[model samples]
Target: MARRDFPRRSDPERSPAPREREPGQTSFLGRWLRRLLVWGTALTLLAAMALAVAVFVTERSLPSYERMKSTQTGQTIVVRASDGSEIVTLGPSYGRWVPYERIPQTLKDAILSVEDRRFEDHWGVDPVGIARSVWVRIQYGQWRQGASTITQQLARNIFLNNSRTFDRKIREALLALAIERKFTKDQVLELYLNKVYFGGGAYGVDSAARKFFGHSGEQLSLAEASIIAGLVKAPSHYSPTADPDAAVKRAKTVLGTMVRANKLTPAESAAVDLKGVKFASEQGQNSARYFTDWVLPQLDLVLPDNDQPIEVWTTLEPAAQHAATDAIQANVPKGAQGALVSLDRDGAVLAMIGGTDYVTSNYNRAVNAVRQPGSAWKLFVYLAALEAGYTPDAKVKDEPVTIDGWSPRNSGGTYAGEIDVRSAFAYSKNTVAAQLGNEVGFGAVANMARRFGITTPINTMPAMVLGSSNVRVIDMVRAFAAVSAKGSAITPYGIRKITSTEGEVLYSHRPDPVQQLVPNYVAAGITDLLQSAVSIGTGRAAQIGRPVAGKTGTTSSNKDGWFLGFSSGITTGVWMGRDDARPVPGLQGGTAPARAFAAFMKIATAKRPPERFDTEVKLPQWQLEPDDESMQANPDGYFYADPDGNIIEPGAQGRTPSADSVVPSGEQGVPVPEGAPAAAGDDFLNRATGRQNEPPRPKPKPSQSPKPN
Candidate 1:
């Protein structure tokens, strides 16, 4: 009866019997849940263990807290002027450290607003900041945001090297956390402020403030504080000294950040006048940028590979540098460029103006530009001629001449026939120079130039006598310095001595053994001729109150103009031209370049007493003139004429050649036929024959012929 009335304990059709169970479904779900829970717990434990291991490794590798406290900043290179004044700080330099209590609150607030807004509220590691930075990086597909707090930066700077690595980042975080534990918030802020790099060789906030605002950190205004704060991210790019506009823009951004953070109200932010934020004057700044740039590359040779600071005593005379800069700026035309180099008698560079403005152009024309010396190069030619038994009194014909179909005429197309060597040089007579070069051989001239330290290539052609070859202004100065130094070879130098901060001598310039580059007599003779040049020649503009010896040069087409001169104490060279080599209309070495040289020399020699060039030269036997009257007569008829216009009778010495003796074309020394009609434009005969008086030929234009070069 119970079985019959059981009502079907499980009536599948009426009771909507439990859906047929999928094979192993219940067991599978239970097993899955158990496995998931077990694996999840294991993964969690593994992750926790890994993190613990990482933290342990990072903490173990960290520098000692005491070591962090004693972190030494980068070494500084102190470049000093010749008078022992600090001209510039070459390497990293830190200012006096400022304590936490001395820091202005506005600076702190500005820095926090721009760099790390959560600096005071969060621990060393701000997780929320890190999450936002990561999201930003993902969105930008680059490292656009740095999650590092000021504490992290301080840790990295003081304890770790600058390296971009996951390990380094993890280590930085651990060290930052350790720092937070070891020091208070104020202490951390103080360390960060005092140890950060602020570019322009400044390493601390106080230094940055002093360097940018010429004031201490405690005196920072809101605008100044914001500017300084903005430089912490990219010191060089935002340095006020390098890029003021960018720095101002960055400061405005920081001000906006301050306003947003409620540290500054809209009104205060608007009132922060960046224009009123006075930057430190560039007056005391390193004006010898060209010299400094030249000296920096040589430091490696003088100093050992050590971290110690060094002092480089350079030969730069600030007064001379200023004079040179002023002269070049004042004399150089608007479209033209100029370079000046001044050296002591010993070849030490006293002043160098590489260009009109170092900020705009740094092409060091004085040392690097190799342009035609033009007539200035005649010094070497005359020197070579003197060495070859020629005297300043030797006679040379300044007549129309052609060498290998290359005809070089005088600048004005007028010739002064048969002049003394000194007279020819004074006038920069091209024909006379060519004749002398032919006699002495171009090789000798080139060799003489090399002996005086001209390293540029010199062509062994007749045109080389007129400075057709290229040479540097420094070479010209060095060559002339040898003349001033009594023919001793000179190695142009700038650094006088280099010493470590501890007073140990790293290097001292011991001048190389001086070899005689030119004979004393030859130097004296050349000096006599150049002195004549300044007093009576194209270089008359270069003559200061004191006696000066120099040569003026103008290249073909007036492309380059130069004046190289020297006093007893200093030798200087000035060059002016367009960098493009385009002719400067109406430009000549006797004009602007000579004037600049004179201006600079006047200042350079103001303290020194005037001294005349040594001119006591003994002539060699071959340089002597013959005593015979006929031999002494100028066979080329280049002699002084009498008032009667008749050929003067030969005195015991000589006489001017008669018009009948005038050599005809294609003839060497043949006399013209008697009663030959006077050649057209024979101004010489108009003065010589006293017959057929004619108006003097019109003086040719100044540019009648291209300059010899």
Candidate 2:
């Protein structure tokens, strides 16, 4: 068979014979190379088809070019106080639109260094970055390397939702290509700088600069720019306000990267440190968030429902907000809640503290919580009496009285028999308030309250005269604001102007015609009564030397302590109580509430021009003679005397309020006379606190530092 192998091949039906080894035939390795090339070519065709299918599917899901071009950034609602300071921002907070040329070159370089070093060289989708990110992901995990270019991020932010899926990533890549084709590199960079989000409810590099460094992006220092650049990686993780140590650490990394990228010299980076950067503390920024929250809902009433960016200018005063927060933090007792609301004569809210710490409880006591006002409600009762032709010196019996089977007792369970109207109001005599309500008619008092802006339900019961009816702190503040406005009807408001970022006025608060809630003379009469209350009565602790008028109120069982005062065209109301209405021990209106009012007004009115209450009306002297019958054997006799003709409450003995109205010495806004005795004025506070003859000293903090926002 072997000898006939060639002849066997000639037989067509037989199997082919084994061929002899031919000369110069291919080797085994060559065969293997051929097989590998064929298989590799087939795999390359299949992969190309897969990529084409992926691109097709992703492009179909992508937003239209027109949609992407017309896509507007999120509508930002920037709310600022009247002083042009930001209180809060609703939705996305955008800063001033900056052109590419205006973008800080250092910031741009830092961003490029940290975000994508080949940003200028890439055409939206970077092959090198994608390969590296893929390798990193394979070694580590997905999301470990974003591999997003500047244009890619812009595309994702502007055109895509934040869905971390492979499909969305493909769509983002397609959108980035489209963006790069439609826009220039410089334009893409500009949009990214203006659209990126920094932590703390701020968006854009400009806002981030202003937020962290208190300057515009154009004014960013190299250090500040580096810090902001680092935030783009993880805003919440590296924010200056959120994690200062992390922020500084990340910023140093950015500087190092910049040096390596040839964008910054090592010496230049070494010369810059954030040590004295002075992260501009908006001293009263968070303190006024309550007012911002209040004004936010009202924007719906004024603005159209379109998604256009807008700016809201509110009536909040930065100084007033700081003062209110400082006072409440200083005087409000531990385990108790406190709130304060201050308004200008035009009914514009200057400041509002919803609680001791907004971080703890955002339940706004100023506008939401309804509670008994105690004697503070007497503001309406006495106002009604004045409207009924009662004078400040008019006599009203302080003897026991009953109405509708509800008999209210005086603070100390005893009342001076037939005191003048001023004395009765100053002493907070419940009996006198009862009699005045009876004479004025409870309905009339309720009408007066309504006229002064109290919208809560009120009853005609006699106890209502002693603040038995529940009301909001804002109601009391508005009523007092009416008095400060010389009896003009005051409608409490916070928003002063609403405008577009383009400077178009959308809404402006128009000054309404002054509607008289009470005659000017009646207002003056009530002012006299309130002034006496602050100077000598239960509200003695609320005196701040300048012409001040106020009233103090203490609910039954000491469940609530309140003080409402006005000075220099500003009216402020303070309330302290437990959220559950449980009694706060020894919490009288004269204790902490009045002290907060005094301290707040002292700082709030410091920059305001000195003002005085008009007291030209001819009337009987408010100062009582020594032979006054009410002073003898009275319940408030020895425990309450101001030696200077003012009456102090027994509970508030030794610490008399500033009796004399002293002019500001123009030094630090303190009203202490330059040549006066050291132990004469505020020295009384020193004596009570065991630091007699010394200047007013700041009290020690009562609790641990507040939680971070």
TM-score of each: 0.64, 0.73
Which structure among the candidates has the greatest lDDT? 1
Assess the local accuracy of residue 650 in candidate 2 as a C-alpha lDDT between 0 and 100.
44
Model 2: residues with Cα > 4 Å off, grouped in runs: 1-75, 131-147, 162-164, 198-200, 252-261, 264-286, 304-306, 402-408, 413-415, 615-709
Cα lDDT, model 2, residue 239? 84
User: Model 2 shows how many backbone clashes?
Assistant: 0
Residues 1-709, candidate 1: write the lDDT tens digits: 3545545476567676568877856677899998999999999999878866766665676566445544656777877789976678866765556788999989899889988999987778889899999899889998788899999998888878889999999888887876776678998898888778888878778768877887777788888889999999899999999999999999999999999999999999998899777798654543488888788788777665866667889999999999999999999877998989899988799999888887778778888888998999999889877776567887888899987677889988999888898999999999888877776677777888888888988899788899989998889989988888878887889999987644678889888887877667788999999999999999999989999999999999999999998985799999999999999987799999999999999999999999978987885322322111111123234432232222322241243345554543454444433433222235455655585666545544654431222
User: What's the C-alpha lDDT at position 29 in model 1?
Assistant: 80
Residue-by-residue lDDT tens digits, candidate 2, 1-709: 3554444345576858789879878889998999999999999999878866766665566556435433566678888878787777777767777778998899999999989899988878899998999899888866487688988899888877888899988878877776676667887888888878888767788778888888788888888888899998899999888778898899889999999999989899898886656676644445677777788888788776957778999888887788889999898888899999998888888889999877667778889999999989989888877765577888768887766677888877887888898999898998888777776577878888887888899988767889988999998898898888888888888888888876889899987888877656678889999999988888888888788999999999999999998999999999999999999999989889999999998898898887889644443322233122111122333323333333344444344344532222443344433323222335443543478567654433544221111
lDDT of each: 0.80, 0.79
In the order shown, the candidates' Cα RMSDs to the true structure are 15.2, 19.1
Task: Give me the candidate number with maximum TM-score.
Answer: 2
| Candidate 1: C-alpha lDDT | 0.80
